[model samples]
Target: MRRAAVGSCPASKRSTLSLDDHAVGVGRARAQVSDVGRQDDPNARVGLHVDFWTVDDPDEARRLLAMGADGIMTEQLRRVATRGAIVAAMVRLTRRRFTVGAVAMASGACGGARAGEPWSEEPPPSRVDPGFMPAPPAPPSPDPRLAFAPVARDAAPPRSIWSWTTAEQATEIRRDEVLFTRESSPTLGRGHLFDVLDARAADGDPAAARLAGVELAKGRFGWSNPWATVRGATPGETYGLELLHIEMRPDTWFARVRTSHEAIAFVDSAGNAVDRGAALDSFERVGGILFEHDVEYTGACATTGSGGGGLIYREIYVGNEARLATFSHRTAAILARLEGDIAELSAFRDWLRYGGGDGWSAYSWSCIAAQLWRSAPSTSRERYLASLAFATDPYAPYAASVDAIVTELKKASFFTPDDPFTHAP
Candidate 1:
């Protein structure tokens, strides 16, 4: 079962908090930082829906403390935390909240019902008459099909079609195969990424504009919408979308759509977004399509350092790798679905690589920076490799959270190469 995280606030720049109708009893005392948001709020769960998570080192964010944000998700928090004493104080206060919770729980020991503690005054029970109720009927025989009764050693063959695909058989088959996808995996947290995607797209409909609900509009392009922000993920509640494959051409600028996750592919001529082995329902759930992100010999992205359009992931639009941009014309955005999972990052990268129609030189693994491999952290580091392993086979061992991925990585006994932002490389 999924549980929401809640905690107190680190001594945030009280000024940054907005005491709306939702937050009663929270008082004001001429707070300091006006843009703190919930980054320093101890009560804010790390995976709860956020308006936005900014990455640009703006002077506006003077300082902050991280709460439940996974390591990959808390880069913003660390950036603000490094800002001298005031921010350090905030971090300290935030970490201290856990201690406070522990202390409170410890103190609660004395308030519980103990063996020696006296009970409240009890009342006496009333007398009852006989012959008031009837007895229950005899139990019925259990059905062998649905019941947990053992199979007879000499029993005849089962009748149901499912007998051919029993749980044990299914597990063995999947173990033998190297690849398989299921409806079980979910996009992190947000059930529908399309909901966020809608907020990010620029639509003319008055109803859509009203529903988009923006405090500040960024042209017709919903590029800068906070809700659709690009960042590491948390588990999504509903399995909103499933991207099977994208169609792209390696030779010419001209392209066609057909489907296959096996190689670079796209939708078919008949408008069928079908894959050989992928379920059609999952394919239709794709809120959008994905592309590849391969390069060789220092491409434009490596050269110019531009953030190609997509936020939340390998930004390529306004950077050196200008070719990393995506579009709805050649590409498709999944609507009303969440496709979040560290494991799925590879697919997204593939989508980026091929969808943008940049002439590929060669498939160079080194081009994919080490940082791209960094998984979501458990305690200190994220489990990027574990996620990739999960991506290879999400059904193999099941992923619980970012922590689960991290634990898997730890079990694999591999080293995580560090990527320092030295001189903004």
Candidate 2:
């Protein structure tokens, strides 16, 4: 049972030593032992115990044993404890290939557990297997609408030339037009002119109507399919709809157009066009303006005993201000401190640093209002609130996040100083 061991070393550093080097080191150490009685006893022996923080995999562990390792000492879950003594070189092997999962799977269970449950054994049936891997779903089809008209890779793409000398501000004008050429089409002029045409004419949108008007003015009246003809106008005369500030992110495509009219930006899984202007005037008749504000958003799950939910503070616009007559406990608390002042509300919202801001969650309406009220005149504050109160939606897309905002709006009330605010979940 006489054992000689080396402390644990990282895999990379240990890889540098060859088997001959390890054997030589162990032999040198064993040769130094001078117990005459032990030397005479054939049963008495000394061996090297190589230490590792983690075995790379089950196969690596078996290889280490075959490489003349008297024993392997590892911090991995394979070790067992009996009456506080850790016993190594156990048969238990992890199903996963990494040490990270090995530690996570066993660490939590080793602490004080329930009366009948022993910490040394595998976790209960309810525990999820860290090694279990899920199969990836099939890849989705590409959207045909996203097909870009090709141009020579070496040639510079035509830029949108704008009238910089005009009195019109850049904010008021749509300046992101791209010169539309047949070569620019993803189909490479393989499809007919009608292929690029709008399936239907713009109903009442002034912006869309103006573009449609330009198509008709090009002597395209005699054309049997006007919509496609309009879409197939001359390169300089027509622009890609994509040039319109379609704010695209890794996961979302938010157009520069009115939010209510966002349906124009829809693309199927295959990147094909579905419908444009489908959400036009969708929220115009819904009544009440959308407003943005922060609330103590919370939720919980009993299965995992995990509690607490994060705040919903990013671009959360609530529809129907009038429906806010029934305020929730959280909303009521926020309103009670504002004293019906608009400037304070503005400061409170502007100060919010969405993901992380120091003490951002502890902000009070009254303190924020008093600090910023002097910065803006009463008239300005009144106008800002008025704008928020009358905000209109022309591109209202159906989404759970948007739906939640609308639901909260229906339960929130306008902040009134005199009204007694009470907690009601």
Candidate 3:
């Protein structure tokens, strides 16, 4: 179990040196190997096993081996091991065939010559044993899942969303448009539309699943069906309702459907769906209520000295205005609907306060407090305070905008010291 070490050789040398006398080993860096040199056959230098260090690239390892490296030290151990296994398998297969061929040749030569006589120019004829016939090659196994049934080109198959219109070649352009793009037939109604979409979704159609989820969340058909559909949905198909606040549990599906009325730019940051006008309207409606003073915008909010004094009044219509407006309008709409539902409100508040663990989640919570005061000033104020008290930890990251809204609301005359809303669980 002797250990070998790697050391550098002199710049003038053109080959690797093994210093067994000093009990030292020498190796080269990639650059050093090219400069101080490489041997055409480093293995020919007896008592030496050339090893390269820190090799991670597959091509670089192959190049080093071609240049006579006996082994390599790599951080990517799994990759190297996998390659070695593949090479070993190929060698084993070749060796088995080589052994068989060698035995066949030996048998022929043994039968041809006598012990003292010279060998004949032509080889002895091979005799087949009457009782020993080689078995014929095995027939290929057919796959049970596949069948090849040919159909006539002119035949029309049964109508389906998954299959093309023709049995063979497509005869008309957009032949399947009626199945997907067109409105449901007058006799079928909207339920049929959803049925088709749901069928497609269950069969692993992402686009159909997404569309069905979005439409179901919209609740145009009614609340009962959407709730039932989403409740029964498997993880494989969330029906585009993956953004629902999970902390709400059994009712989270309904919350997701309820909140769909307000457009939430869940993934995008460009504020493409943000309505700046609606946000300004919300701010105008609730500014005086939250601040408890005349709401007027001064340039002070943009400066560090403004502190928490100006708060929502100065910031709402300033930097990231569209985002603020969008958040205000969307959250306020959703919160307004949950006014009397204390259990749902608490769950929603928990999601807003604690879900900012990642960049996208943090951004989603940034303006969650926006326009909330405008929904129902007194109720909103109490709800906001209750949410703050419910938090076991500090507010999540990117919650400064939400904090500004809370700060402004604290100045109201109705602001209370104790929790405004309470429930057992």
Candidate 4:
């Protein structure tokens, strides 16, 4: 696993946070950041999802508090000084709404289920009977061949597919691998990159125009139109468009078909146009084709900066619509074989968090960061900060998160702390 280097941001702007920066919240605001998106009322109570984790600096938290944050919702207490800093800041803000959840003390937030608490009212029971549920039927035993559980016994780990490298170099190298589908190309190659459409090619072209319109409709009505497809003249035969792969990134490459009016679209190789507000990388199973992210450089992504690149993982473009349905059925069998421990892991996660009681819900700020650092790519400074903060912490909880992630990773194969971000000193 490779960690993207911590890049610098302008001094005047918020400093770019690394993955190890951890700060814990003393309080838990019930409101989520998503609530603000629906209605930008700063006056209303809102919570920062990861705001209360441990961090070296309190400036970011202080700034957010100043902007009318109601309270900090956190799971664990950090260092005394860091805790003190957050407490001091919380005291300064007179407008914040405070609520005492039952577990607020361990979480370091103000509020609790005190007697006469306004939020402590109990609700009436539901009308449905609670004791009449039937016992679940036992699942059929799985075939031994289908199971690929992670081994528990200690052994030498499998070799990693690759080793450490910089994201810039990785991106450049991955870019070179994009092969374009040539005029005589029969099969789509891995590096074969092609543009869906261009400005000049789409302009005044009715086919391109229709696609553009569909794109607009997708934006306006998300997931509403299931029948949206290339309306007129497919790009391959109609436009005969070829891509300059050297310039295009895998995540950025897409096909576009013009239609009547000013409609234009970014489509997959199967000519399935992207819906509005949908990510291009998520264009999987378009016309029964499988797509996956091309680049392994899972780092912070931006509209302007680098993103996870893309490549056509499989080509399943059967000519007939009826045949496509059959192909889709066959593809399911293949995907079933490909699906790994995600389902079992997810079940474990739910059981631990929901059924394991109070202990499972709480985690050290640093530990959570460390787990995330090893498990997923950081796409924002905030996430990086949490990872870095937790990774560096000396606390037991920090170790717990790290150990948990390692254990989970080892379930499928042997685990190694090779990535610089997660390497334990």
Candidate 5:
């Protein structure tokens, strides 16, 4: 693979290159074919585009994958390697689905896997809990008690989430939040919530089930009904949860969110989207940003830099800070402070390019910090670190990056050499 020098493309020249061989050759060094599903020109197609916002079911994943996609444009990249988890879920969905033709075969155990239902050859389940399709989502209470907060779509659906998938819950959120409506949910008014379950079944590893969801508990970090035994999971039981990207790319793994629709982002390297496998929960194109939250900001962090362990440079504040502003319309103000007379909502296309500026990872201290902040009554740096993106990597170089930037700033007369300078991550 190859890496291009940043900021090499000019705007005026864009009209000249739709699928430029030279540009593609540059990308070929890295073995990449950008789909750019979120661009302004709907007519513009570089042979493909991917955005996880419209889909959140394993069925959707299967569809995209069938389409021969290279990569899913999603934030949840770690779920791709969940073949093991998928196997476990299939076992639960169809007991026979786990036999030779199902789980055993998918695992490459040779003779065990035969030809039948839930086979690796078969399609993934799209809809679970037929009756519990779309739940009532949470209302955007816009409570002043917190800073910048987003309520869950199925936070309190008219019906119970007991038989609903997290995708269904997410549907509710998109529909109700006039500002956040989606094709999946037409109701237009509700919030969706999820729970996380880590339970064990008496016979086998329930967590090992395919398309399975110990599922997440609503309004809380964990689950309420710990176990819904296979014997108890009747013909119509609803279940769903957001699977967090525990690691990105090279180490694809998901921490599994106890919430709705986070799973939709999982796609195989072949670009084959998995159904009911993962679901897209959010999509907003306010700033020409096909920016991926689960993709651009997975739950990973840097071990050798100022940001470590899930230490994604992406900062989401509950309060009205410039960080949230960057993701919000406030983004307009901050960029205005930094650049020239560029003012359309699409200006974010330029900011997206700035991603080279920072990064974080899951299992890192930095990720821990982010969670801590989101869960606070009154947030702080220390508390944020508790559940943030800082990595346990021994050589966190926030100081190093700071020093380099400081040196440049000093040279530019922004600060005097002797000035007492401090760098914080």
Candidate 6:
């Protein structure tokens, strides 16, 4: 004779399936299954199947299956049978005034009963029983700070695939920037190299714009007035310079060229200049230019700067060896950032479309944003800005909120989980 016990208790507190070779019983208590009673048990007393009872939630059923349960007994046949339709419908409902919690309850109850509670003869509450649960309050209005304002199509182009910078590429870029800044002079004559490059940049030469932007950012060739230098330059030039200024050393040269819009210096929470990854920022900005221009360069093999005196003229034809290296390195970094941003955005969008309707998706988004705010607020801001530029309609609100929150976060010197600015909500 084989024995089994079927019981109900808080799923978190106790198991619902128990079996042995003796007698069968059902009650609200902790389950005890012997190895011999399990079908998979090597020393088997009986070939017993482990099944859970009264599982109304499809999510719970899935969880049980993962835990090696043989079968599940769920009352709501339609919900379990039409899981896809229910989830899709819930997504539609979430767009309305109904709270995510309400939709979750309408699908299925998460737990069987409270711990130590006795089973009652009364029937289980109806899955959609309005009488069992009060009407959920309407969702709060969108935060004023996160209010969506559509940017121009030209300004925020559709998302595109991008690759990450490799270690070798990064090393090459750093080497180039350092060597170029040391060896090359931005002067061709009294007029300066920028005078010609600036005109070329205006004429839509991405390479020229990039070179000129880097020189202007470094305050080379007697370049003063950051805004004035870039005033007539291309959009790529302006953005590239802005990125450079954000991480450039704040010295006499930087001071002479820094715009009012640019930060005096990027610093950590302790007010110390963040120098550890500063070089990477420079590289990334340069990379952005290359990506915008859709240009490619081979690594160190691409340029020969050591040949002879004709090197200066060769640079004018191509680009400064150092500048070219930095360009390639930074381009790789920009591609990496884009790749990460796209992956995160895709996952977020999927969550919005097919996430559990128990408000966990929204909660997780807030948590991730908060974590990024604490660890890398600037990165968070840049990511959101990218998201705003690239995200589709379904996820625009989330991106906008994060963008707004970054502004608030920038005002604070330190961060805590409880900080109001840490989360978009």
In terms of lDDT, model 1 sits at 0.21
lDDT of 5 by residue, 162-276 (tens): 1112445444533442112221223311112111122222224333232122221111111111111101111122233321001012212122222222332233223333332
**2 against 3, candidate with superior TM-score:** 2
lDDT of 1 at 268: 36
- Runs in model 5 deviating more than 4 A are 1-357, 362-366, 369-371, 374-425
lDDT agreement with native, every candidate? 0.21, 0.22, 0.22, 0.23, 0.22, 0.25
Tens digit per residue, CA lDDT, model 1, 93-133: 11111000110100111211222222222111121112211
Cα TM-score of candidate 3: 0.13
Tens digit of per-residue lDDT, candidate 4, span 112-174: 122222221122123112232112222322211222222111111111111112244334334
Who is ahead in lDDT, 1 or 6? 6
> Residue 398 in candidate 2 has what lDDT?
11
Q: For residue 1, give model 6's deviation from the true position in Å.
A: 35
Worst 10 residues of 5 by lDDT: 283-292
> For every model shown, what is its TM-score relative to the native structure?
0.18, 0.15, 0.13, 0.20, 0.17, 0.23
Candidate 6 C-alpha lDDT tens digits along 310-357: 211100011122322222223333334333433444443233232112
RMSD of each: 25.7, 26.1, 30.3, 23.1, 27.6, 21.0
Best by TM-score: 6
- Model 3, residue 57: C-alpha shift (Å): 46
Question: By TM-score, how accurate is candidate 4?
Answer: 0.20
> Lowest summed-lDDT stretch of 10 residues in model 1?
98-107
Find the 10 residues in a row with the least total lDDT in model 4. 221-230
Residue 378 error for model 2, in Å?
27
